[model samples]
Target: MTPEEILPDDLMERIRGRAAGYDQDNSFFHEDLAELAAAGYLKVFVPVPDGGLGLGLEAAAALQRRLATAAPATALAVNMHLVWTGVAHVLAARGDDSLGFVLKEAGQGEVFAFGISEAGNDSMLFDSGTTATPEGDGSYSFTGRKIFTSLSLGWTRLGIFGKDAAARNGDGELVFGFIGRETPGHETLTDWNTLGMRASQSNTTLLQGAVVPPERIFRKLPVGPNQDPLVFAIFACFETLLAAVYTGIGERAFTLALEAAKHRTSAKYGGRSYAQDPDIRWKIAEAAMAMDGIQPQLASVARDVDALVDHGPQWFPKLVGLKVRATENARAVVDIAVRVSGGSSYFRGSELERLYRDVLAGIFHPSNEESAHSTVANAWLGPLEM
Candidate 1:
């Protein structure tokens, strides 16, 4: 079946309904992903000949949003596969055939680790002294530890970003090769401790000069301070997906706050109802408004990103602008959740408290603040030939 037929309509609704219960019970999410693999949802972006949906970023963004709203941790788990599947799909459809097998494997229930981070200094986006250089015998050895890798349990492949440091920096080039998580020299060190995205199962990956055959490597693509259209689309999708999940988390938090407010009574004014006070009422309205405010911007950004890919890559800077807004809105969603939940929301397992911790994950990504600064500076200084 085509990607359009990959998931039944009932399954989508089922995943949505599954979200409400995931926090309370994780059975469905932990297994549903494997189920998604069985059904080929994981490889939808890959084309038919390669055994995938051949879907574009627009559809991928929607799927990302849907899974994210269902279970934040589950969404985090799938992000690894989506990224691998995406680049691999492009490679396959564009005529590189080897990567197609990995996509097929992914569709058949195999998973890859996003082993980008490292232990000493944070390096998820950039390679932190990791190197993939050639051995005299026609193979390259991957060395160095990667920290905070997600869905580390039972993974089969890894999308690692490393540089052939022997070359100059920037031109040093970053490569994300697909490697077996259990490759002989590879080691996994557990120590997942996080305040949010709890149960994400993040851990450290140590490749002790693990040797990867040249055949295991997908050709490295060019990336820079200013990325190409495909890279920008991935970044846009990442930001948009994060925004939607935070919105979902906030929605749950707001509901908790509203329910608490409705039943809460205060004796400060001699048995006055807390929910009856104008100040308290304003918080509820504000939280609802913030939640409502995010939807249009989300839809707009998704549409613009979709339109750009089909036309040309010239307009990525515009999509980045929308992504920046979504990133800021994500932070706002958390603030609204906190405001409406009030003090008592701190109780453990409180959806507000959980979501508050969850939202923090959004900002942990590359500094959008820095990205914005450079963009504005470049635009003001005016553009020219690269």
Candidate 2:
């Protein structure tokens, strides 16, 4: 199905209307989540036979971009669930059914969340700060903290990873597994208050011996980077979907700027429309040009992933590049929108004001500016000559 069909204009308007309220109240998008779930939005990656939309990654990215145009925080939070399901879909399409359960559970209406982020583990997917102690029965107990756990209140299954320090004869292994919300050892702190994206409520999670049975354990890769399809799938889905959200933000900002330029009259220019002002026209054109370049990149990368295009070592660079470009461009567009929309946008309840703050969060996601640059550099220049 098309993005418009998945998220109708009326539904988007309702979501847009709730965004400011959720931000002001510093609350989760409970209503939005319920509405989206009821609309079968959370299962966009699940197969048709499993009762989902059965759309590809490109389509899923489009849907997310559409969702973000209405509510960025909600879209950001929902991205966590979609990431896991998307990863499952990616892996399954590659003949790996290891995460097939994710699809099944999601199709059954269970919410899956991405829980791999840590406080200071910059190694990202390559390494883990969390400890995964192996059990006698092949299960594992995870003990560590996972920060920025989005959908904290709504996730039924959280996909997390940690290092089993004792595995591989002390070489260590990164253990990936899923823990249910009913698990007794994890706690979600209500400390998500932030400068923006407040509705995401992405609080920190403390895992105090959260155990996953062998059945839930999916991958056990050696410490540090490797050529695992699971890694590719996670990075591909996370980065592309993330880019889609920010691209949507940029699209919305550009639209708002266009409207402002057309309607706002300039007193200094004899009450003429700002659109007639040369500077305002220039800013609008700048935003439009910036936004125009991102959709094609987002579309191409997402389509490649869905089609299983093999970029080899260049894949990481492509994924990270798309994320960095989309996010940075979106921030620039929001900034321009704020500048063109006049001082009223500075008000707390103004959507442009909120977007300005929300867009700043793009710098904090994985494959950040520094990381993206490093990845691309290494991909081109080869790893630093030690």
Candidate 3:
């Protein structure tokens, strides 16, 4: 089904109406979350037999793009849950049912949030500063802090990982697992006040000594990047879904610029609409062209993931490139939209103002600018000599 059919225009309008208020109050999108859950949006990536829409990655990305057009913060936060479900689908398709339970729980209305991000851990999933101590009973205790834990106020389960320096003959192993919100030693700090995307409530989390049973400890790979299906699934879902959100931001900004250009009249132009002004039209066109290039790239990467197209070493480059393009293009579009809309968009409450802040958050996500460039460089040029 099309994204419009899945999310519908009226739902988007309602969500859009509340976005500004949520930003103003630095609040979570509780009402929007409830509405989305009721619509089964959270289950978009779960299997059909599991009571979800069973959408492929491409279709899910489209829906996320549409969702973000109305409420980027809400869509960004929801992407966490979708990422896990998407990861589960990816694993299942590859004959690895390790995360099958995630899909099942999602179908049953359980919310899962990503908790892998850590302060100063620039290596992203490849390495961790947190400690995962293995217990004699095959369980592990995680003791470290996690930053940017989206859906922090509402998630039932949080997927996290850390390194066990003593495991695998002191070579160090990365332990992946999930723990409940009420799990002992897990603390969610009320520290989400941010410049944008405030509704996401992506607060810092402190894991003093959270335990994960054996069944929950899914993977125990070496301390760096490897040929693991888990790695592939995480990168594929995270990068693709993130790109979709930013693409939607750019799409919305482009539309707003078009509307502004058509409606606003310039007295200096003798009552002609700004749409008739050469400079305004040029800015609008430039934003449109840049924004137009993002959609197909988002769709192709997502489709490749769903189809298991083997890019091999090129996969990371492709994923990171799509994310960087979408985010940077979205920022440009928002800038053009603000310019084309005149000083009115610069007001404290204008949608463009909030979006400007929200779009900036994209740069700080995984596969950041420097890391993305390095990944592409390494993929083509190989690691630096020595």
Candidate 4:
């Protein structure tokens, strides 16, 4: 299906019109979420039989990029739901139906949100600050805090993880599971006020004895990193989808610059349009070149993941590399766009201003510049001597 089918231009414009208001009010994309759900966007990754589009990762990435071009905050918030469904699809395709329920629920109008990120938990998936205490009745109670929880206001199910301190002979076990929003012992804190992506409303979440039934507890693995299908699925969906969002941001910024170049005039250059100015043209060209270089890489990685083409140990490197490239290059494009658009972009009401702030958030996501660089270096030179 085309992006136009997934996200109609009329709906996109509606969402775009509300973006500034949502950002200014520091509110969630309630209207956008409702529209997206009604349109079955949350089920993009579910199988066709499950009443979804059944698109592969490549197509989903493309659709997300398009969505972000109109309303980045809405697109980023929806990405969490897509990530969970995408993970289920990936597992099912690999002959593991462990997360198939995710697809079924998504198709049934359930919203899934990611609850993995925690404060000071740089270990990402390998370790967790939360504790999952097992009950004799095959249920586990989680006690900890999660940060940067997107869709905090609307998610029906939240995918969370914690460390089982007593498991694996005290070697520590990482337990992953899903919990309902109505479940006792969890609180969604209304403290999402931030510099950018305000419509996402990603809030701090606290879990105190939140229980997960045995069937819902998905993966159990060692405390540290290892070869696991679950890990691969998470990285594949998370990184690629995230890159697509920022790619959309960059794409929009580039288009804005091109339009400004064509229409904006320079008093110093014989009343000629900025498009005729060699320096302004150079800036646009530079931004276009940088954005052009990363598009193929992003497309290739997403398609390769869908094709199940194994890159072995290099997979993490490639995924993180694509994320870093897309995000950093997006920042560069936005910067150039701002420069080309002149001082008007510096004002708070400018679309370029909002995009500038949104693009900055890319560097703060997982596989950040620091972690990405380390991963690539380790991939090439092996672990450090120390």
Candidate 5:
């Protein structure tokens, strides 16, 4: 189904109307979450037979882009849950049923959140600062701090991983598992104030000996990176969905700029609309041109993932490259939009102003500018010399 069918214009408008209040209060999108859950948006990746829409990555990305236009924070926070379900689908399609339960739980309305990021842990998925201790019953107890845990207020299940320092005969192993919200030894900190994307309320989570039963324990890979399907699935889904949200931000900003240009008149030109001004038109054209290039790239990458096109070694570069381009392009588009939008965008509560702040968050997500460049460089130039 089309994005419009899933999120009607009226529903989008209501969500757009509340974006400002949520940002201003620095609160979570509780009402938006409820509405989205009732709409079955939370189950977009689960198979139709399992009570979900059974959408592919391309379709899910489209829906997320559309949703971000209305409420970026809401879209971003919700992306966490979609990532897990999307990962499950991707893995299962590749003949790996280890994470099949994730899909089943999602179909039953379970909310999943990612818990991979950490403080000063630049290794990302390759390694972890968290400690994982085997409980001798096939279970593991994780003790570490996870930051930027979006959906912090609402996640029923959190996917986390840590290092089993004693495993692999002193080499080490990374244990992956899922823990419930009601699980003891975990705390969600109430510290989410930020420069932008405030409504996401992506607070820090302290996992103090949180345990995941054997049934929930999934993969246990070597210490460093390897050709693992789970690794590829997580990176693919996470990067693609994230790029979609930022692309939506740019799309909305461009629309608002166009609207502002057509309506606002310049007294210096005898009340002529800014749309007639050469410079204003040029700026709008630049924003449009930049936005035009992103949609196709985003669509192509997501579609390739869904189709299982074997990019092989180039997949990481493509995934990280798309993320960087979409994010940087969106940020640039928002800046141009603000310039063409005049002084009103400078004031608080204006959609453009909120977007200006929201778009800045693109720089902070994983596959960040530096890391993205490094990944692409490595893909083409090989690793750095000693």
Candidate 6:
């Protein structure tokens, strides 16, 4: 495709049209995102050798920012693949043979979801109620329920984690298994709903005696008694993408508020333009300022991500700092977006309402304020490495 056809001019317009009814219609745009996947957006950063376009981080970041402005949830859901898949691809490129098949499958639009969060683990992943005990035949019986397994039934494979069953000295490791969701014992319950990003279809997947073959394991055992630094580094990048989506939600809210206020007629004391209301205009201006103030930092973090490819493992802590600072920035932008939109914005069909809900997704990501801060500070001054 030529430059004119490169981005598909109708993409943004299409997303905008879907934005109004995204929660109630389009059936989650299950088909449209498939087109995006076919167009290579889904495999944007996977290397060409792995049957991908290898558009690189800079291009991916640009696309990330652009897509967030139109359909934030598409961007949100895509991040699940984009952030982790890309990092996993990078690790695969380094000759991690275990991930080769997974990366190749992803390049062909194969879908996998990260299943990290769970119920009653007390917030610690390793101690989750779920367990995968080895059955002595190179397969394991994974037993437990996982809550908030976003993209539950729709996923082709789920990156399930459990305590490594083969620990000799009692220091166990996290074993990531890419279990097929269609397995007989694996079932999904889409009974849960959220205040925002309803299209995320984030639901619970029940695993009762779900047998996982050893071939399904993605990251297994340790790297010769050492852990991979890429895990934490990749996590930092996901948080940044979340921050980017939050930033875009605020921008959309600001745009909608400006357009609405300019046309709204003041009802009190002889009709005047709502734009003429001194207080309303002032609030809009403040939101605009907040939007302007936050974006430069976002841009800087994008640049730092590019720098990561060259800086290597040392960039882990820096990327964590970026996520820590920017998630707060995104939360700030969403707050201002809601404040400027006012009470009417709370209406079920309002754009601000969806944007507000979508932005909240960032605050709940694994690398929220507290987690990111702790990681960054530990990397900086800890006596024992975390």
Which digits, one per residue and each the tens of the lDDT, describe model 1 over residues 1-386?
43235556666566545543554543326656666777777776666665667675556655665555445666666776676666555545445565666767776667776777665543334444678776866567788888767777747888676667555554765555667756778887666666667556667888888877767766454334434333543455555555555555555566667777777777775676668867778887887787677766666666655454353443444444545554566566556656655677777666666666766776665435556555555665765458
Q: Weakest 10 consecutive residues, lDDT, candidate 1? A: 221-230
Residues 203-237 of candidate 5: C-alpha lDDT, one tens digit per residue? 99999999999998999999888999999999999
- Per-residue CA lDDT of candidate 2, range 329-383, in tens? 9999999999999999999789899999999999999999999999999999999
lDDT of 6 by residue, 344-383 (tens): 8788877777777777766676655676666567666763
Supply the global lDDT for candidate 5. Answer: 0.94
lDDT of 6 at 336: 65
The lDDT, on a scale of 0 to 1, for candidate 4 is: 0.93
TM-score-superior candidate, 1 or 2? 2
Error of 4 at 314 (Å): 0.8
Model 3 CA deviation exceeding 4 Å by range: none
lDDT tens digits, residues 1-386, model 3? Answer: 78887788899999999999999999999999999999989999888898999888999999999999999999999999999999999999999999999999999999999999998999788899999998989999999999999999879999999999998889999999999977898999999999999999999999999999999999999987798999989999999999999999999998889999999998999998998999997998799789768888899999999898999999999999999999998999999999999999989999999999999999999989999999999999999997
TM agreement with the true structure for every prediction: 0.76, 0.99, 0.99, 0.99, 0.99, 0.83
lDDT of 4 by residue, 1-386 (tens): 89898899999899889999999999999999999889888888988898999998999999999999988999999999999999999989899999999999999999999999999989999999999999988789999999999999989999999999989999999999999988999999999989999999999999999999999998999999898999999999999999999999999999999999999998999888999999998999899899889889889999998899989999999999999999999899999999999999999989999999988999889998999999999999999998
- Model 1, runs deviating above 4 Å: 1-29, 35-40, 48-54, 89-99, 118-128, 136-138, 167-173, 221-230, 261-277, 308-324, 379-386
lDDT of each: 0.62, 0.94, 0.93, 0.93, 0.94, 0.66
In candidate 5, position 45 carries an lDDT of 93
Better of 5 and 6 by lDDT: 5
- The 10 consecutive residues of candidate 2 with the worst lDDT sum are 112-121
- On the 0 to 100 scale, the lDDT of residue 173 in model 5 is 96
Off by over 4 Å in 5: none
Model 1 gets an lDDT of 0.62
Candidate 2 contains a number of clashing pairs equal to 0
